[model samples]
Target: MGDRKDVRPGVGAPAAEPGRVAYDHHWARDLHSSIRCSAAFLALLFAIDWGTGDLTWWRSALWLTLALLLFLVLCPPRVCAGEGWMASRALLRSRRVRTDLLVSVRTLDGVAQLLVLRDAVGGRVEIDPRVLVNNPDLWYRLDEDARKSAASGCLRSGTDTLRHFSERLERETALTVFRISGLDS
Candidate 1:
């Protein structure tokens, strides 16, 4: 037992593809939440119409359409990162950026924080920072490529931002490990 090697994969481990890895760990949960929210809204509207005796076929159809719109608004994009690229796909469009060729990174402050990355190739992607916080594998791929960008003098801005973000990620990961090992107390 002492001589046995651990088979668990690490950050540097090769995925099925040589250096390609996609992160969608939270996609299913996000999709389910979107569906639940839309269904609940539709059910509430129908209940109110039925209770008031104002339900009609046209009204039902309108409610369904509204519910679908709500789902579209609530749905989160699927994010994936490979060796040199990251992509976010929504219902209508997909955005991708070359991580290794990144020229700029911008953080937009709003109700939800957005991280915008633009590459030398004119490809750009805007993603929620929480996605990186939740997915270490995705973060690792991006970080590895970003270092390359910096070393190659392609990255012109957001070096401090990436550094701070990486520190935060490290702290979060350490805390999670402590919590899991029952040593957080």
Candidate 2:
């Protein structure tokens, strides 16, 4: 990761690029966490079964199947900067302060989503497994107000947060937004 991109409030000064804003690998971290949780759950079930001395074949099969299912359900998918990853990579690259274009991506759950707010009408959109790739350094360098605005936007409008982040990035460098997963959290 490069140096943190400082987010100035409304000045729109294009500061020097903070080293290099490497892509963050958050999906792997989340997948690891999911695997660990699934394993722990399976272990707990096994331990309970062993302590109770109830090793029925059906129970064993059932527990194994359940654990497998849970892992499949919880594990984050292997993702990169693929086509399905972000909705507005092009928009992110070409536009600056364009509120007319927004990006929104759906999560694996299909309910919660991460959005990139280029402006009121347009921004970056995110979807499942890909949402796990949010970059922390890119996020941290943001000005306090921008962060707050994004966080609040996340709470209010899912797509609005994209603007704060995009704005932060635009303020820092001219490089395109790169998404990576599995970097140190």
Q: Pick the candidate with the highest TM-score.
A: 1
Q: Which stretches of candidate 2 lie over 4 Å from their true place?
A: 1-24, 82-112, 116-133, 136-161, 164-185
lDDT of each: 0.92, 0.47
The TM-score values for the models, in the order shown, are: 0.87, 0.42
* lDDT digits (tens) for residues 1-185 of candidate 2: 98866766688666544343323467668778888988888889999999999978899888888888888777654322321122222211332222222223222343654433333444443333234325544333223324444554532443344454456556444333332333324
* lDDT, residue 69, model 1: 100
lDDT of 2 at 54: 98
How far residue 128's Cα lies from its native spot in candidate 1, in Å, is: 1.1
Per-residue alpha-carbon lDDT of candidate 1 for residues 45-83, written as tens digits (9 for 90 to 100) = 999999999999999999999999999999999999998
Please report how far candidate 2 places residue 24 from its true position, in Å.
Answer: 4.6
By summed lDDT, which 10 consecutive residues of candidate 1 come out lowest?
5-14
